[model samples]
Target: MTDSVGFDFARLSPRDRYKLLIGTVVPRPIAWVTTVDPEGRPNAAPYSFFNCLSADPAIVALGIEFRPDGAPKDTGRNIRASGCFTVNIVSDALVEAMNVCAVPFPPEVDELERAGLALVPGVAVASPRIAAAPAALECRLHSFLEIGNSREIVLGEVVHAHLRADAVDDRLHVDPAVLDAVGRMGGHGYARTRDRFDLPTMSLAEFTARTDASDA
Candidate 1:
């Protein structure tokens, strides 16, 4: 590699390491997660450090951060209390509401109500799902990885899912264009999923043939 910046993560400050990670990760899928407290009050929050980890059991992971006061955030606390939550896919139209959920509101405040998003009863989980969300995955807490003081990695098994009517076909194939999802970029930035291209996996023979042809 040519001249590239390097860092010793062990020596770097946590904040600096975080900055680099978020900056280089480019666009990350936003998981607009919802969970319910003991009183059944729903809590909503957006976490970019989230993705599907397994397909066989349908597992999704969310990197939930703790508050600066060393206490778990509302969503984290609610998930631990309820053992279930909903992961709502954030579409372009719901970006504003998603941002509203990210606000550090008090635990007593209902983010769904404050954001003016409709919440529907979750079929498989106690947590509610955002009705406006293009797709919502009802997840049961499979496991929790307590890595450090900063964040907790939650691995959830998707028990059920809800998708927009026009976004999916009978064959269960989802149309990305119809979903119109958005991703979180570094520091107050976001990216659209519209501009996309497809590239098929190539066989070794095909790859060799292409390389020979190019050499010729």
Candidate 2:
């Protein structure tokens, strides 16, 4: 195999590099977010720059991008206005519904209704959680980190959580085969979380004993 020369990221435009980076990062987890406007209209959108920032405090974050004219997107605006939102985990069975939320519909348009997703009222916040999702985190805005023109990293504390009956066990180990979670994979590509394996970690003494046993 021949080695290729590296391309300077600084030389390329931000948009170009962003596309390259997002495209190369395979199987990103999708955050199917739900928010409400000042007028009580529901809004939903899918963002991949999302993850669990904290577990004890139950904090999840989303890196929201601004419009081309350096304006906040609908999701950002709604969250800023209401201070509450829901992060719904996307599954293979609900990929189509998740895509429906991605449509650039008018502010008045209810993506949940368009996607035919059921809404379960949240406990700690006014925002409603998606019933189709196996797990939903009802969050309240903790803080916002402004990155650049039109980009903000939103940190939210999960005040309430809803898990599907069949998804979790007494030990809280979620069954992947049952969840069938889907992940983003650059462009229009996506991946299923079905293919999984387990690797158990061993203690130092156990490792040493295993080595000694192998030698014997």
Candidate 3:
């Protein structure tokens, strides 16, 4: 194998570092986060720096970036104020609507309505979920961490999840084909989950047998 070029992140500007990271991360899941302000007005936004961090405690983390003017974004502020939010899983059908929500709308604006997406009330949280989403997780704020002036990490404990009835099975296994999730790629690209392959984990004995077979 040839040696790979490396760039020192410490020397790179924040924008350059972000560009490199996002460009190389392949496809990241989009968290269509929904939150409500103090007056119960709904807000929705899409964050690519979001994922399930823990299964036992059902924790999800969102890396929310502050606005260029050094103020928290509406979604971040709403979550901070209410201590709860809902994360809707973006599917292929909802990608356009999700992008509409990503627009930098003013705090008073309802992105959900602007995007023309239907809303469903959250059971465990005051925030609502996108009715078109394949799945939605009702999360309460577990913790909030200020990483730097640029970003805030919001940790949420999922209290309840609503999955599309036909997408999940009795065993709680979700069918990716049915879900048809869309993931964020670098730049203006998005990826589909339809092109997928499964690889089952192998036991030690199975690994040894495979090795032996290869050697033979």
Q: Candidate 3 lDDT (Cα, whole model)?
A: 0.92
lDDT of 2 by residue, 66-152 (tens): 887887889999999999999989988999988888988877777889899888888899888888798888999999998877579
Each model's TM-score?
Answer: 0.97, 0.90, 0.98
Off by over 4 Å in 3: none
Better of 1 and 3 by TM-score: 3
Ranking by TM-score: 3, 1, 2
lDDT of 1: 0.93
Estimate, for each residue in 60-148, the C-alpha lDDT of model 3 and write its tens digit: 99999999999999989999899999999998888889999999988888788889988999898899999989899999999999889
Error of 1 at 181 (Å): 0.9
Best-fitting candidate, scored by TM-score: 3
Q: Which is superior by TM-score, 2 or 3?
A: 3
Tell me how many clashing residue pairs each candidate has. 0, 1, 0
Candidate 1 residue lDDT tens string, 1-216: 699978999999999999899989979999999999999998899999999989999999999999999999988888899999999999999999999998999988888888999999999889999999999999999989999999999999999999999999999999999889999888888999999999999999999999999999
Q: Which model scores highest in lDDT?
A: 1
TM-score of 1: 0.97
